[model samples]
Target: MSGRCKGGKGLGKGGTKRHHKLLCDNIQGITKPATRRVARQREAHLGAHLRGDAWDVAGLTPSHLELIYEEMHGMLQVFLENVIHDTITYSEHAKGKTVTAMDVVYALKHQRHTLYSSGG
Candidate 1:
């Protein structure tokens, strides 16, 4: 097996009937770093920084980053969807137009005030 990646090995009916090779190339992918950007890692770093003020982050590990990243991303996705949906509904019915960036900004502002406007 050469270093070049291979796919679909055929071995059936004396090489007459080609059988699809289910396990061809390595399923785990190459050992080297992936060329694509990993968003989860980036998200984790942001979360670590956000909490660094109150917690010691000098000994954080890759696994910890991934766990925090997953939770942050999961919760943010849900929150964003809800925010966008509410803004879209209001903008469409009230203004009779498509949503815009201002809609998002307004939604965010409204949510912030609604949730965090306590005596200040």
Candidate 2:
């Protein structure tokens, strides 16, 4: 049997095993923050890129933003899994043996999301 992994790496059987391990790690957030301070710092750094007028600072407190970010992160984790599963299904049906960019595009379309490309 061909031992290629879903993401197209072709290191044979060991690659397949490693791919599954990586996928599981990602879905389980193996690198996620272990404390509120880390989460807060991440959120603050993300916000630092915004313009001075980008947000109404008086509106949302740091605590509120942290909770919102936490919720958003959880929702995105589930969405990410769904996307991966759909892409795998699409690739398998096409008999391609690997998930390609088009497979991801179609998978997102199946999930009711469209990705736009920018002209260079």
Taken over the whole model, the C-alpha lDDT of each candidate is 0.56, 0.68
Per-residue lDDT tens digits of candidate 1, residues 6-110? 665455623555576875334234221331133435446568654433433337797885575556555555676689787887688675557866666667776
Q: Which lDDT tens digits does candidate 2 get at residues 1-120?
A: 585555654456334334353344353453334433445555676777753545433588789876765675677678888998999999999978677898899889889877768210
Residue ranges of candidate 1 with Cα displaced over 4 Å: 1-56, 113-120
Off by over 4 Å in 2: 1-19, 22-58, 116-120
TM-score of 2: 0.51
Error of 1 at 106 (Å): 3.3
Clashes in each model (backbone N, CA, C under 3 Å)?
0, 0
What overall lDDT, based on C-alpha atoms, would model 1 receive against the true structure? 0.56
Each candidate: RMSD:
19.5, 9.7
Say which candidate scores most in TM-score: 2
As for model 2, its CA RMSD to the true structure in angstroms is: 9.7
Worst 10 residues of 1 by lDDT: 27-36
